[model samples]
Structures are given as C-alpha cells and as structure tokens.
Target chain A: MASPAYIAVDWGTSSFRLWLIGEDDSILGERRSGEGMTSAAQTGFAQVLQSHLDALAAPENLPVIVCGMAGARQGWVEAGYIDTPTSLSAILTGAVSVPGQSRDVRILPGLAQRDRQAPDVMRGEETQLLGAIAADAKGEQVVCMPGTHSKWVRVVNGQVTGFSTFMTGELFDVITKHSILSHAVAGAADVPADSTAFESAIKAAFNKPALATNLLFTARAGQLLHGLTAAGARALISGTLIGAEIAGALSSAGQGAAITLVASGRLQTLYEDAFRTLGLTYTTVDADAAVRRGLSAAAKAIWPNNERKS
Target chain B: MASPAYIAVDWGTSSFRLWLIGEDDSILGERRSGEGMTSAAQTGFAQVLQSHLDALAAPENLPVIVCGMAGARQGWVEAGYIDTPTSLSAILTGAVSVPGQSRDVRILPGLAQRDRQAPDVMRGEETQLLGAIAADAKGEQVVCMPGTHSKWVRVVNGQVTGFSTFMTGELFDVITKHSILSHAVAGAADVPADSTAFESAIKAAFNKPALATNLLFTARAGQLLHGLTAAGARALISGTLIGAEIAGALSSAGQGAAITLVASGRLQTLYEDAFRTLGLTYTTVDADAAVRRGLSAAAKAIWPNNERKS
Candidate 1:
C-alpha cells in the first residue's frame, strides 16, 4: 500500500472535495461534503479540514493544497489573483501559505481580467485550465467550463488571453424557480424530458441571440397557447440560455477556434448536444478528472521532494 | 359635481385601479388597491370590486368597464382574446359581459398573436394601445410600454400587426434580488443612482444584445476588480435588461417607424432616458391616461346613450 503523501482539496462556495494522494501520485482516498468555504467559514476551516482528514484516517503531517473559494477574501486566506494575460504556470507561483498550521497548507490564487469594458474574474477554473491544456499546446483554444456560472476561456499558445463568465446556469435556476416561467415549468423533470423543444430553443437563441429574454417568455406563452408540456417549457428555458451563452462566447472568439469543453455528467451531455445542434466543432474533457489532475500538478510543483515512498 | 355615469377599472395581475367617470367625461372618484387577479381570485373578484364601488358610493345601476387581467381566463370571467392583424377598434367589439350583474359589466378582450415562431399575448397593454394610438392613425407605429413585462407592439395603419414581450423588468428584479448579483448590489438604491453605468450598460447591451448574460456578470466583476459602487451595479443590471429589450423590440420594427412610449412614473423616466441615450426618436404618452381612455372608448362603444347622462 502506497503511503499518503499530501491532500488536495477543492473548496468551493457550497461544496468541498478532498483527495488523499499517495507518494506514487495515485489517489489513495477521497472525501466529499457540503463543508465548502461558506460552511467552513462558520465551522472553522481548520476543523472542517481536520474532520475530513480524520474521516479518511490521513497521516497527521500530510501536507494540504487547496483551491477554489477557500482562497477568496471571505474564505480561509486571501491567496489573491494573477491578472491576465498570464501563463497557466503563473498560478503555481501565486499560491499563498496558511501559517501556523500543523502541516504545510497552500491555497491557489484566482485569475482576473482587468479590462475596463469587459472586466472578469475566475477562481478554481484556472487550475482546471492548467490540467486540461498541455503547457506547450499550439494555436488558440476556446475552453468552456459549465456550472453555476459558465466560463468561456480563451487561450493562445498555453497562455490565457481572456475569458467571459455567462450567468446562464444561475439565470436558468432563478427563471425556473422564481420568475413567471416558474409556473410554466412546475412539476417538470430537472433534466428536461423534451429533447425536441431543447434543440429547437438552442437553434432559436443561437440564431437570434438578441431575442433571449423574449424566447424565455415563449415558454409561458407556448404553454398557454400551444399547450406545451412542463418538461418542454423547462427545456426551452435551458436551451435558450445555453444557446445565447455559446453565441456570446463565440462572438468574441477567433473564427474556427478549436473548442474544448470541460464538463461532466448532465452538463457534458447538454453542451455536447448544443454544439452538435449548432454544427460547431468541439472536444470534451471530463471535469472531475481535469480538476483532480490540476490539483495533482499543484501538489507536485509545490512539494518536489515528496517522491513515491514504496 | 356631475353625477357618476360609469366605472372604469384596470385590474391586473398584482394591481387594481378604478375610476368613476362623470357625465362630463371627468373623474368623479378614484380607487386603487393591490387586489389584482391573483389576490382577487382567492377573495372573489366580484366582492373585491363591490367593496371599492361601495366606497365610492357608485349608483347601483352605474355600468362598469374593465380591462387587463380581470378579463383573463382565471380572472372574474373568461373574456377570451382578439387575434392580431385586426384593427385597434376591433377590441371594443370583443368585450365579454359578466352574467347576473344588475348593471352592465363588460370586460374587454386581450390581443393574441398566434405566430407559431413567436406566439405572444397582451391583455391590459391592448387597452393602453387603444388609447395610445388613434383609431384613424396612419403609417407604421412602434409602441413601447415598459413595465414588469415590457410590451413592444407594432401597429400598421391602426391595425395590430404583431408584438413582443420582454421580461426586462422582471429579470432585473430577480437578478438583483435572487441571483449572485444581489451581493454586488446589496443596499443599493432601488432605482440606480449611477447614470453613467446605466447609460453605458444600455449602449453596450443595445449594441451587443447577445452578450447580455456576460454583461450581467460585470456587475460583480466590476465591483471586485474596479471597485464599482452598489448603485453602479444596480444601474448596470437595469440598463442591460432594458437595452436588450429595446434591441429585440426594434429588430422586427420597420425602418424609421415612429415609437409611441406609453408609461408613467419611474418606468416612464427610465424608458425615456433609455430612448434618449440611444438617440431614438419617440413620443411619450401617459400610461394611466391611455388605459382610462381605452376604457372610455369601450364604454362609449358598448353604451352610446350613457354619454352625458345628465
């Protein structure tokens, strides 16, 4: 059995994931919980990390590397941000140390684009970019990371040129849960059972991205006038938001740029279908694997001497 | 004072307004409440209307004219709809009468555009349109009525051609209150105090409606990176939604089509500012007066002899 060398934690706003990495650079154990930055802030970050490590029976001296919102101003420690255009490797150098811990603890910094007109910032995803794209990759790449706030990042020859964050997922949640469309989608399946409505909405929004909000209204109007099903209405809302996001993302990208989608589970299937429906060229990367790989890269870079102990 | 001749009411989803008209076409009494369809539906629409009428001491035989959601399927009675491509005066003939009432009580029908691609409907706005545009008006007219669900109707030579509904005001409300942008604009003035942010956001969204969701994120990013004020964030959100709405509304409008803006109060000021910032030519009309005028037109058409009863 390979001995555990270090712990990798992705502490987001509402979720926490920890991986126990062996000396051989393999995952020995993992723990996931709702003890993210928000929860950890109240429960004590040190205590939360200790509880997770204790659950896994990790070694007391196991060095920990953390990413995501744990490094935010309101989180455990302010790791700050590396402003663009920056090399993916620059993130490694910006890690801030949490002093007075029993073991070495470092948190990765976020990335900020200071453009006055299109100001943007991203946390955690920058690490995923490090793992998803090879350090020496050639040409321009458009990377999409879909979640609560879907991010479309542009990379030119391994350096992140810029990126934009679309409030697609969050808007979909609010519109379906709080807006008038809520009634239109009441009792609907979360994933939308109506694929046809989803695809058509994708096309409609992609072609006329300007009519996004109007298209959203059609969910209710369609239900009232055309007797559209609840599932169909939900699908229409999701597809419209996703389609508009893609359109807006690509609008600023160089024509024919290779697309790299970083997502897993339902988001992966949805985006793949959207790209196919829009007739766009793209490839996919497993999000979980990418983030894990990203954490591994950071672990190795920060602790070069922690080689495999057979 | 002239004796009360009839009662005019604009009963909407969340609002109720009533005015007792005199024989001289003046307001004899006025009442306003929050007992719109949603509330009145539970408490009995007839009961709600009676309470207000009783307070005004309206004559037992005084007839009533109603518009807006009161005519909706779920309101007092199912008033149905008048299909589009019809004349504005056609709305007057489609009034549905409430049965078992001592006095004549007629609820005007709404307008419905059954276009499969863009199915749309409007209840109260049609009445506003009836009063906003003259029956014998000529040429193409683009009417912009801003509110919770802002309506943009396209009329050709006094005939209702088609219209679009943008969820601008509602989206702004949800995004600012329910979404992550809520934090960026926490404690900000309800109406944005940052005119610069508002105007800039308006131009940005109007010019690039596709990037709306992305632009929305800037409210947060701007705060984090550029130290944007809470008011600025609020203004940006409002401007983005309104800008996208205006762009979508004008996309189908004929070139140089005259714009008739029917709005009052804060909405009137906001939309007026938007039109001016965009350098678009338009004429403003009071929304309250327009709805009242529409109800008056319906009353005269339904009971010609009621005019100047004194």
Candidate 2:
C-alpha cells in the first residue's frame, strides 16, 4: 500500500469530534465542537467543520472521513448502512461522497439489517468496533459499546460480523423519571459507580428476573407502603433495567464469545461490577479510544493506498 | 355577585377551550382555539384570552376563572396547586391574579402534595376531577381519567381527596415505538386491535404477576424461539401494561367506592376493555362532559351569588 496521511471524525447526535493524522498513524491536532447532528442542522455542515478545522490549523484539503449519525438521512450526507455480516470495507464502499472545497470529505456508511423481517439499522458504532478490532489484532474479540442506544457487536478478522441495538439509556431515563419506578428513586443525583445500592439492584434484578415488574411496583408501593424513598426506588429500577440490558446484550451476542467492553461514564463502572456478579470476563476500554480508532478505520478505507502502517 | 359574569377556562396543554360560564352556572357561550400553553410564550397571554374571547363574543373584562395547565408556573397566571382534600371553592378563594389584564381573571389553583417526603404537584387533572365530582353529585367516587399522563383521582363529598399520576400513554408509545416491545408491535397499517389478544395479555401479566418482565423478554425470545411477530408481541406488552395500570388504579382506590371512567380516542377503548377485564362497576363519561362540569364547578365557586339551582 502507498503511504498516505489520514483524517478521522466521530460525529454523533449531540457532539462532533475530529482528528488529523499521518501515514504512520501518529496523531496530529484534534478538535471538538458542539455541532452534533442535531445542531448541525442549524449550524450548517460547512460552518461546524470550519470552526473545528480553523482551531486545529489543519489543511482542509485532506481526505476527511466521518462516522456516526453524520451519515444518517438527516445528516450532511446519507452514507447509508451496510447490511449485517458485512465487513468494514463494505461501509467504505458505500460511503456518501461529500464535496469539500479544500478537501475530499467521505461519510462512512453505517451497518443495517433489512432481511430480519424487521429492518433495523446503525451507522457510527460499527466504525468504532472496526477500530477496536484493528487495534486488538486478536481473534474472535467481541465489543460491547454503551450509550443512549448501546450496541453489542461481534467481529472476526477486522470485519464486523453482526450487532444489535438496545435503547437502554432512553429506557433508564423513562423508568426512573416517568414510570411508577420514579416513586422509589432516591433523588435526581447520580448513583455512584459500583455503589452497594446499585450493585445490589443489579444482583436482585438478574437473579429473580421475574420480579423485575413487581420490583417496579415497589418503587411506589415501597415509598407509600414499605416506606422506601423515591430516590432509592429509582436506583433500584435503574439497576434492574441496566442489568436486564446487560443480560439482553449478552444473550444477543451469545455466550462463549470473548468480551471487550468499550464504555464510559457511570454505565461502564456498573457494567464491570455486573460482569463480576455474572461470572463473566471483560476488558474495559475507554470509549474515546474506540471512537478515535473508528475515525481511523474510515480514513484508511476511502484512501486505501494512503492508509498508515503500524 | 357584582353583576360580573365569571368565565371558567379549561385551557389544556394542547388546546384552549373555555366556557363563558355565567355566575348562575349557565353557559353563555363556549370558545375553542388551537393556541395552547406551549405557544403562549410566543403568542403572549393577552392575545390568548382575546382570541378565545372574540370567538365567544365575550368581554375581556369579565371575571375569568381558569384551570388546567394555563395556570401553571409558566402559564398566563402562575396559580399554584392546592393540597389534597381540597374543595373547589377553597382553590378558587386562593386564586392568583394575573398581571396586566384589565379584567378580573381569577386563575384557580391546582393541587399540591407534600404529604410525601418529596413534593408532588398537579394542576389540570384537579379541575377535571372537580367537574366529575360535581356531575356525579355522589358522596364518594373514583375518576379514572386516561391520557398521556393518566390520573386516578379520588373525590369525596364533591372535593378532590387524593390522586396519583400514571405515564401510561407515554410508556405505551415508547415501548411500542422505541423498545424491545416494538419488536412485537405490528405496524398500525397492518394489525388491527384484537380484544381477545388484549385480554390474553392481561391474563398472562396479572395471573402470575411476577411474569411481567419475563413476558417482556418473551417479546424478543418468542420472536427468536417461538416465531412471535413483533407486532403481536407489542400488542401483548400493551395489554400487559394497560392491565397493570387498571390493576394499579383499582387497588389504589380500594373497595366500596363509586367509580367513573373518563377517556377519549383509542385510549378510551383500551381502558374500557381493561375496566371490563377487571369487572369494575364504573360510570362512563365523555372527556368533554367532565371538562365542562369542572369549569362549572370553578365558576360556581367565585360567582356563588349568581348560583343556579341544579
């Protein structure tokens, strides 16, 4: 492969992050902006990029690559989603070409499932997993990435085999704030990572499993009848949903696969603790690392000959 | 009392429907408008009243009584909520005067509950319950008002005694559209509501009770293991939650209470079926009818001198 410089970008629902690198994969100046997919609609694509590019003092003509919601139908360019059991190269092949004045902008395609009888799709996370896989260089490594819509992806030979989405973040918010579960929640305050209360909640929910619903009722009934505080009850409900999410993800990936957990914020801590409770093994990787790698994967794809070698 | 006609407006979150109610408890004229609470911040308070008043051909200076979200903290007048066991008259007596309005517009306060450790407040549902209580004229009755945020209220001696709010509609929408529950739901264009299926879901959820979460998992597992349709599974989840809501309301109200059921749209049908499932002895009333009675109750309070014989 001919040596060439690469650029990477991780664009999401509410935030945008970009990076510049060389043929050897050494990092250059990196930039971030609040111009996520939502605000990008108003801020304009060119402006969000310019603001960050200007700050980085990087050449605009570089073959810029993008991953995440930026490729969504509402985003800058609809790169589309690569179907399941497809390789990262398939996404590169499907990239939506965005004409950049000073540079070549290519939006990485996301992954999708249309034949499952239910058409579901994803874009950004696959790029992250590809980066993780490329970095790991290990065989049969699975990546569990947590977010508003958490994903459990399987990979083999630097190609994403398959993945499933879970609306864990949204569910947690809803159950704790809007549902009967809110009555038992202690307060609006965040439950500390690996806290006994949260850990206990995880254990109870996964253990009894059937009691999840009845446990929800306890949020209200506990406060009124059993004198459980709203905050505590909320935590209990959160623990249950999250624990269920972990179980759901594991079941989707199928057991016996090696695990690599890519996470951040409180969820990672809780998930780690849950892993111990369930007697599972995992390697926790920082979320940003995978995202950066995701950006690199896209960069290496369009300008294949320019891809950096380790 | 001073020859001034008192108007009671049940200005909801989405619509502004007012009663140009007379002190003698007679409707002079009624007005409707698309302008609601959300648009109030832009339309201006004076304009909101003028637009509605113009439709009814009523004078702006009339002693206007307002309930519902229109009297929320950010409403035309921030009339606070009264505690439980509150009388319609007591709330009217504690009305907060709106600023800059030439007319004497008394925005009747809603209800507040600090009886629990944390304070919980409610506004619009209070007036609807007042209307239901007034219309029934029964000593003790429970009003099962269904909506996005459904409220189960207890009225005793024509007063709102206590109540609880359920995020039923919101939860149903979230689950069917956004969660694993969505996997089970048939597209609206595809499967129509089947009561038998609904009944079966309720029985499965309530029978063993603890099976609610397991039942939810079945939405995913049934699709994988048993080949259950996502649409059908969604229906089951819908049936279960609604069934749980009905069970929750009935249990909260306890026995030996006269009950009135209030709802509209598909929710009305679902709730009706749910009430039927529980064999509840309830008096069914149209949503609009209760709102008018609620307005009439508020009007009767401040304009007692012009009271009409029922």
TM-scores for chain B, listed for all candidates: 0.98, 0.81
Give the whole-model CA lDDT for all candidates, comma-separated.
0.93, 0.67
lDDT of 1 by residue, B1-310 (tens): 8888899999999999999998888999999999999999999988999999999999998999999998887889988889988999999999999998887899999988888889888889999999999998988999999998999998888899999999998999999989999999999988888999999999999999999999999999999999999999999999999999999888889748889999999898889999999999999999999999999999999989997574
Please identify model 2 stretches exceeding 4 Å from their true place. Answer: A1-4, A134-142, A154-161, A174-187, A191-194, A208-214, A225-231, A305-310, B1-170, B173-268, B271-310
DockQ of each: 0.88, 0.06
Give residue A196's error in model 2 in angstroms.
Answer: 2.4
Candidate 1 per-residue lDDT, tens place, A64-172, comes to 9999999999999999999999999999989999988988999999999999999999999998888899999999999999999999999999989999999999999
Against the true structure, what is model 2's DockQ?
0.06
How far does residue A215 in candidate 1 sit from its true spot (Å)? 0.3
TM-scores for the candidates: 0.98, 0.56
The sequence of per-residue lDDT tens digits that candidate 2 reaches over residues B1-310 is 2233667777777778777765555667877876778787678867888777877777655677777778876677788667767765567576777777787677777776545422345667766666655643658778888876677777777776776665566567666665545645755433326566577777665453333433454555445434666556766667766665565555557666877888666767777777677676777777777777776666666666544321
- lDDT tens string, model 2, A1-310? 3233756788998888888777777777687877889899887887788777777777645677888888877788888667777766676577777874577788888876544322345668877776666644656767888776777777776666666555566667666655545545645476643255466677765654434443444455445434655556656667765675666556546577788888877777777877787788898877878777767766665677765333
* TM-score between candidate 1 and the true structure: 0.98
| RMSD vs true structure, all candidates | 1.2, 9.6
